[model samples]
Target: MNRQTKGVLLAAGGASLWGGSGAAAQYLFSTTDISTTWLVAVRLITAGILLTAISLAHAPQQVRALTHQRRNVGYLLAFAVLGMMNSQLSYFLAVKYSNAPTATVIQYLQPVIIIVWLAFAQRQWPRRIDCISIVIALIGTFYLVTGGRLNTLTLTPVALFWGLWCAVAAALYTLLPQSLLKRYDALAVCGLAMLVSGILLIPSLFTIPWPHLSSGDWWLVIYIIVGGTMLSYTMFLQSIRYISPSVTGILSAFEPLVATLLAVTLLGTRMTVAGVVGSLMILLTTFLQAIPMQKILNLLGLKHHY
Candidate 1:
């Protein structure tokens, strides 16, 4: 297979696993008394150890080199607290308050958040297409939360808050890793970040009572840490080596698509027509942002130069 084909497959598989993990988390939230705090802590810690081990096996010298750098280590710790930890914690909290599908869809607003942040930081207006995307995101979010009804909300106020926070955290998660990713291996940086964040959360784990999970629940937990978090992250990162980041971003829509399907079918979650429309609109923004402007102009048959 061609590199692009392999990349597509890898990206899709990774996204699907991520989607499935969200559904699995919803199941645990619905059936058990597990707190997001404990679960996030354990997942990060365990996944960190396993991923770190793999990174060590593959490139022991690189991993050791990263630890010896003080400046990069400081950056890694900041990312651990403000990026990885916040993103994971807010995400599952959003899922708990809303559903996996809604939370996942809302989290896709990360691109929009990043765009806005960049515009402000650079002291420039967003491009016309970006402005359009922003408008679409607002309209879509309205319909998603209210389901076309102004007086009644489909999602609770708390759910909406956490969902928006999840988007912010996700944006931070993407942005804060740039420097580290450039200087060190992605897996090594991520593993160390996860380890630090998990360590920080360890005190909270003791504050909350341990959950009594069945054997089946334990299996789901393992899947979330291994298949969903570790393997999925590895696959998604690997795909970028074979394809453009834009292509990988576009393919990531599968995460929400799979999550929505699993939530609706397996969990019997109900979504209104307006809600579905809103979800599609929100997801469409990702494609719009991912597609290069030249390609979009070609599709529209506009030959004017930028």
Candidate 2:
């Protein structure tokens, strides 16, 4: 396969793995009585260790860059706080308070925020296709959230609030590192971010009750650290080198769709036709948003920026 093809596959794989995270977390939670904070702490610590070891093995030069660029390291540290630590913690907590499908759909709202941020930063408006996509996505999200029955819009207030927080965290994770990426390599930035997040999460470990965790619990933790966090993130970073961020973001729509499938297959969750239609609408919106419609417009002799 070509390089771009490989990158697309890698990105899709990453999204699939991320989508599976909900199922994995559910499995772990079923096997253990671990709290969200505790789970986040453990996952971060383990992922940090694994990532550190990998960086040392394959990219020692990237690790060295951190020691030399103090300012870059500081930015990465801040990114870690919002992107790694807060994002994961908020997302898992949202799932805990609400259902996985609801949390996943809410988290998918980050693409819209990304487009808005990009437009604001560039001082331009989104393209026509993007506007259409956004409309489709918003309509879809409304239906999905209400589960097709508009009267059932009585969502759990706590779930909705935390889920919105999770969306904000997701948006920050997508946008905050653009400046740093201009200066440093993605691996270096990701490594430093993971390390910082791990360090910040350490304080929580002291407050969390540490009892003897069961064998299954330990395995689930390991799976989440290795598969959900580290591997998925590495794929995402690598994908950006080959594709535009818009494309990468759009491909991420697969995450929620895959999560829904996992929910049905692994968790035995059921959905109505309206729910499926709403999910498709949301996914379509995200995919439309990801495509470089601006470039297409430019090619077609249209004068617009997105």
Candidate 3:
């Protein structure tokens, strides 16, 4: 297969791993009494250790570079706090307050947030296709928030607020790494971010209880750290090496679809026809945004530029 094909597969695999994390986390929450803060702390610590070890093994030179770039280190620190810690914690809390499917759908808005951020940075309006996709995604999100019950679906204010925060955090996380990746290697970025996030969570370890967790809980934690945090990120970085970041971002929308399916199968969550339609619309919009119609036009020899 071509490099781009490998990249797309890696990205899709990463999305699948990420999708599985929601189910794992939901299962952990159901089985354990761990606080959100504590669970996040443990997750960061474990994921940090595993990722740091991987970086050291394969990219020791990148680790050395991190020591000299204090400014980059600071940026990574912020990235860990907001992107890793805050985003994860807020997402878990959203799942707790609302259902897994709702939280997952809300979290999928990150792409739209990134588009808005890019527009603001470039000081230009979004492309026509982007606008259309955004509209479709918003409609789907609205249906999801209402649980497909137009008249009776009311959201808890806290759930809505935290879900929005998750999207904002995800966008910030996505945008912050661009500058870093432009300057440093991917291993350095991932290592520093993981290290900093682990350190930031250290204080919470003491305040939150760290009692004995069950065997299943331990497995869930391991899955979160190894599969969700470390391997998934590794795949993401590797995929970005061969694919455009925009394409990778679009592929990430599949995470919600996977999560929603898992919620239905594992958590026994049900959805209405409107909800299903809305989800499809959002997914279609994400696809359109990723592979713009103009690109298709160019591919077909109908246009010179996209």
Candidate 4:
């Protein structure tokens, strides 16, 4: 296959695994006494160890060098706590309170959040297309949460809170690693961050009562850590080598699509027509941010005066 084909496949596979993992998490929450705290802690620690080991085997020198740079180490620490840990915990908490599809769709708002952040940081107004995208995102979110009724909220307030927090945390997860990713091997940076975050959360695990997991449950857990976290991340990163990030970002939409499908089919999660429309609108924001400005204006039948 061509390089582009390979990248597409890799991106799709990674997204599918991520979506499947979310469904798996929802299943665990509904059927078992598994706490989000325990699951997030275990997923991070185990995945951290495995990814770190792989990085050590591949580039031991880089991993060691990273520890000696205090500034970079500080960055890594912040990324671990504020970025990685927050995103992981908030996402699962959202899944716990809401269904996987809704949480996944809400979390996809990261790009819109990132755009607003960048515009503010740069002190430049966002392009007209970007402004439109933001407005669409807001309307989409309203439809999603309220199901077109101003007085009603489809999701509980707690779920909405964590879902929005998950989006912010995910934005941080992408933003905080810029320096580390540029300076060190991506694998090394990610592995170290994961390790640190996992280690920090270990103490809390001790305080929470352990629930017994069956062999089937164990296998699902293993799938989540290995397939969902480690392998999916690896594939998603690797795809950037073969395709432009814009295309890869577009393909990442598969994550929510798969999650919605699994949630509806296997989990029997219901969605109103407005919810589906809202989901599509929100997902479209990602595409809007990616495509050219002229094309967007044309699609909207608006003249691009600027």
Instruction: Write down the TM-score of every candidate.
Output: 0.96, 0.86, 0.88, 0.95
Q: Select the stronger candidate by lDDT from 1 and 3.
A: 1
Q: Model 3, 60-102: lDDT tens per residue?
A: 8777676677876777777878777778888888877766666
Query: How many pairs of residues collide in each model?
Result: 0, 0, 0, 0
lDDT of 1 by residue, 171-277 (tens): 99999989878877999989988888989999998899999999999999999999889999999999999999999999999999999999999999999999999
Candidate 4 global TM-score:
0.95
Global lDDT scores for all candidate models: 0.92, 0.76, 0.77, 0.92
After TM-score superposition, what is the CA distance of residue 135 in candidate 3 from its true location, in Å?
A: 1.2
Model 2, stretches more than 4 Å misplaced? 1-5, 118-124, 211-213, 240-250, 297-306
Flag the better candidate by TM-score, 2 or 4.
4
- The Cα error of candidate 3 at residue 4, in Å, is 6.2
Candidate 4 per-residue C-alpha lDDT over 73-169 given as tens digits, one digit per residue, 9 for 90 to 100: 8899999999999999999999999989999999989989998999999999988778888899999999999999999999999999999999999
Best by lDDT: 1
**TM-score ranking from best to worst?**
1, 4, 3, 2
1-306 in candidate 2: lDDT tens per residue? Answer: 887888888788888788878667765555567878878877777777777778778878877876578876777777899887888888888777765666787787777777777788999887677777678878876776687676786347787788878988989987778888776667667766777787787888898887457887777677778888889889987898887778777778767777778777887677767667776886676777667777788999987766
Q: Which stretches of candidate 4 lie over 4 Å from their true place?
A: 292-306
lDDT leaderboard ranking: 1, 4, 3, 2
